[model samples]
Target chain A: MNPFSYARASDVADAIRQIAADPAARFVAGGTNLIDLMKYDVEHPARLIDISQLPLKSIEETPEGGLLIGAMVPNSDLAYHPLIEQRYPLLASAILAGASQQLRNMASTGGNLLQRTRCFYFYDVVTPCNKRKPGSGCSAISGVNRINAILGTSDACIATHPSDMCVALAALDARVHVAGPGGARTVAFPDFHRLPGATPERDTNLESDEIITGIEIPAKGFNANYSYLKIRDRLSYAFALVSVAAALELEGDTIKEARLALGGVAHKPWRDPAAEAAMRGQHAGESAFTKAADLLLQGAQGYGHNNFKIGLARRAIVRTLSQAARGMPQSQSVKKIR
Target chain B: MAQPGTAEPLRQTDVLPEKIQITLTVNGTRTGLAVAPWTTLLDALRDRLDLTGTKKGCDHGQCGACTVLVDGRRINSCLTLAVMKDGAEVTTVEGLASNGTLHPLQQAFIDHDAFQCGYCTSGQICSAAGLIAEGKARTADEIRELMSGNICRCGAYPNIVAAIQQAMERS
Candidate 1:
């Protein structure tokens, strides 16, 4: 890590102003991902504006009966928050299934959304990576890419976003609240993260000067059944090879509404409304689920090593949807797809 | 007088050009130190403060060998900057034992033979200590899931789980 001047932001305005003034400065929240990148020489900031001390640490109830989660709220706190566990258990389960206790204690909600891909080539400075350095040829395109992206990938980059919480939030219709030099704006979860198109260096649609202040999870009617299932190499402390967040609203045995999002397969949290629509008014069973799974993985073109993820993701969707339909507890959601 | 939770203003001369002076309440002792912005909390504890109980297995936060308590929460100290945690109370493995007595987790580790090489012991114990405080680990499976951050390459997981369960029952 290079030497940098550190300043703690007293408020949101101060954080934005400080970062806007220096293009070389970056906000340091949680430091779980940023510090790791700095150590790997993938990121080198001249100044660090510490936003951890800011007042954005509350997880509160909005006037509309929805939840407003502060950006600086630790992952563990958000995961175990009474309102989150009760109302948005899928988000809670995804978080707990992503990282271990120690990491969850340090990682923040906003930072988790901005976490970089875990692609080996992106971190290895010696190797050429377009995501790490624009115009630098992507090594993962020709190198080991078992964990690479299979959806929303471009010729420039094939890195997948490694966030399980965001996958659930995508299914729950969450919005990101950001403040920047222009003004404050709300970005829908789908638009917040950008696919690795021409400019793979930028992971999010967030401007360089903007600071993520909070996340707003709108009060949704689909609260009957939900499941977040993560399939990884290990039972714990490993990134998801393929994960599914399935939430269903059913009338008796027929699905009235549904939301499906996938992780470990796309540049962003992969959500297809068509797949969700296929389940409407249909019986919540294998046939309907298999149809939705097929629609969800329709254009999922996989890299060589990660071709197995295509099949793994399809089965995971089926299993997670089954669990959600039965209203099984989220504890049974964490499984290793073989 | 400043507000209770408000942070103190940055003093230019406190850093001596590149190093900044920050107060950290480590092991219940309030101490002031100066360090560069790049210095990790693990380095501050081991190199500057001479508290070497926390081992650095992988400084990238992948391995939990550098686990320490900040505000009673276990975090990989290697991943956090020392300057970022001014005014926070940090507890390392050295702080676990009090007044010449071993912490219950430490005692249980010995009783259950929870370690082989023991490089990751302090971190494992510290992480287990934090887990115990959270009061979420009810069964051996839950304990294993929660404590998955701390890696025991020596393969003493069975004993480690046994020790944590024994400690949880006693408490």
Candidate 2:
């Protein structure tokens, strides 16, 4: 990692001021992803504004009957929090599904959203990764891409957003709260992450100067019938190969409403409101799920090594929806599909 | 306790550069040290403080060989910058024992023979300590899932889980 100057931010305004002043500076919150990138020579910042001490570690109930999670809330704490575990169990399951116990303890909420879209090449600076260097050409497009994106792909990049929590957030319709020099703004969760359309370097719509303050989700958490199913090479401590976040508001056997999102197969958490609309009023069964899966996987093309992901994603979407519909949310502990 | 020359300039130059001065309460003692911005907590414990018990397997957060308790929460020390945890209490494997008696988990590890190389033992123990404290795991399956971060190449998982179960029961 490059040597850098460190200054602890006194408050949110101070952090914004410090970052806005220097183009080469970056905020260090959990430092889980940023530090690893620095060590790999993928990211080098001249000045690191430490925001770990900032007062943003609270998880509170919003007046709108939703939840407002502070950006600095550790993944482990967020996963085990009473409100999250009880109300937003989908989010809890997603958090526990990704990484290990030690990482979840160190990683923060906002930093998880900003984690880079990566294949194996992104971690090695020696490889030609377009996401790391724009217009430099994407190696995963032609090389090994077992973990590359299948849904949203550009010639410039085909890497997937390796975040299970974001998939759940996308399904829940969460909002990202950020504070910049201009003012505070809430970005819709889907709009927060950008597709790798010729610009894979920019992962999210968040500006360099804007600091994420909190993540807000409205009242409907889909607590009764929601599931976060992560398919990976290992049972745990690995990135998802094809993960599904399925939430349904079911009236008896008929679906009242539905929210479906896919991770590890797209530049961002892949979601289509139209496909979810197709599930409404239909019986929650394999036929309804297969049609929704087909709509979600529309135009999903895959590289040579990752062509299997197309079919895997389809089956995973169906299985995950089946699990949610049966009210048997996938367990993070017992990872084997039942 | 404040050591005599520990406070000396890290660069020893007439003109001072940017090594930030901070205090870390490791185990039970509060030691003052000046560290660079990029200095990780694992390096600080092993190099500066001579607390080599916290091993550094993967400098990245992928390996749990550098697990330690910061402010009573278990986190990967290798990923944490020393400056980021300025005033925090860091409990390494060296601090697991008290007054010549090993921590119950440490004792259970020996009884179960949960390691072969023992390089990942410190991290596993520290992680297990945090896991038991979290009170979220009650069964062997839950222990296996929660302790998945600490990899044992020796494949001593069965014994490790057994050791953790005994420790949990004792606690």
Candidate 3:
């Protein structure tokens, strides 16, 4: 890692002011992702603003019938919080399914959301990747395209967002609160991450000097019947090959409302509004889920190694919806769709 | 405080420089030192403090070869800076044995033949100790998940799991 100046901020204001003063400054919270990038020489910040001592480590109930999670809250705490487990079981499960105990203990909520892609090409300095080095050719396209993105991808980049928690957050319609030089602002979870359009170098909509203060998620009535399914090559400590986060609200065997998001398939958590729209008013069955998944993956383009992900993602959606629907009350059970 | 030729001008250099005083209590002893701004806790413990029991496998937080405890909470020491942990109590593998007696987990590992080359043994032991403290070894699935970060290229996972389970039962 390159030499860098470090300063432990006294408070949130001090952290923000210090970062705003230096363009090359970065806030180090958990250091789970940032330190990895630094070791690989991918992220070379001149100044590291340590904000681990900030008083933003709580999980409180907001006035608007939602949960406000502080940015500094560790992933382990969030995964095991009683409120999160009771109200947002999908989020808890998603957090548990990611990384490992040691990593989850060290990774904060804000750090998890801001984590970069785990693209092999991006991490390997010998390879050329536009996301790692601007204007550099993408080596994953012609080399190993197995773990690359199949949706929301561009010719310049095909890296998938490697986060399971963000997939659940996208499905739950959470909101991110950030503080920067311009002041505090809220960005919806879906819009917080940007696709690699012409510039794959930029990951999120966060400004260079922005600090994520907290994440807010409005209470969902259907959270009681939610599920997060992540399929990976190994049973533990591995990124997902195809994952789905789904919540269902059923009205006497028919779908009243549904929210679905796919991970390991797109540049960001792929929220399929069309799939959600198709599930409404329809019976909660495998056929309905299959059709909706097909619609969601209509324009999916995959390479030779990852073509199986489309089918895996479709099946994952069906299985998740089925499981979530089964967990609902008896009155919600209707005719099972084949 | 009015001196002209003071202290050789502090030797100016291009490297971004900042020194922070860190006082760590390790294995029942208090030690103080000035570490560079970017020095990780693992480096401080291993290189500066001469605690070579903690290994550095994948320096990028992927491997658990540098797992340590700060105030009873387990963390990837390689991902944390030593200066950021001033006055914190750290427990490494070197501190596991007490009064010349091996810890239960360490004894179980040796009895079960949990490791082959023993490169990742110290980390596995430290991480397993923390895992037991956190109640992560309740079930086989939970044990596998909790110990996932510590890789054993010798494919000693089955024995490692057995050793951990035996130690947990004894504790």
Q: Score the docking of each candidate (DockQ).
A: 0.32, 0.34, 0.31
Query: Which CAPRI level is candidate 1?
Result: acceptable
lDDT of 1 at A268: 94
Model 2: runs farther than 4 Å from truth?
Answer: B1-17
Docking class of 3: acceptable
Regions more than 4 Å wrong, model 3: A221-223, A328-338, B1-16
Q: Which residue pairs of candidate 2 clash?
A: none
Candidate number of the best TM-score:
2
Please list, in the order the candidates appear, how each scores on TM-score for chain B only: 0.90, 0.90, 0.89
Tens digit per residue, CA lDDT, model 1, A238-315: 998999999999899999999999999988999989999999999999999999999999988877999999999998
Superposed by TM-score, candidate 2 places the C-alpha of residue A222 at a distance from the truth, in angstroms, of 0.9
On residues A1-338, what C-alpha lDDT tens digit does candidate 3 reach at each position?
Answer: 77788888898778889998988888898898998888777777888898988999999998989999999999999988989978888888889878988889888999888999999988877667888777777888887888878898898899999999999999999999999877899999988999998899888999887899999999883656777788778766889888888899889789999988999998899987888999999998988888888988888988778888888888888888887888732111121222
| Candidate 2 per-residue lDDT over residues B63-115, each given as its tens digit | 79999999988999989999999899989999989999999999999999999
Task: Determine which window of 10 residues in candidate 2 chain A has minimal summed lDDT.
Answer: A126-135
Alpha-carbon DockQ of candidate 1 = 0.32
Ranking by TM-score: 2, 1, 3
Deviation of model 3 at B42, angstroms? 1.2
Candidate 1 at A322: error in angstroms?
0.4
Between the candidate structures 2 and 3, which one is better when assessed by TM-score? 2
Clashing pairs in 1: B15-B19
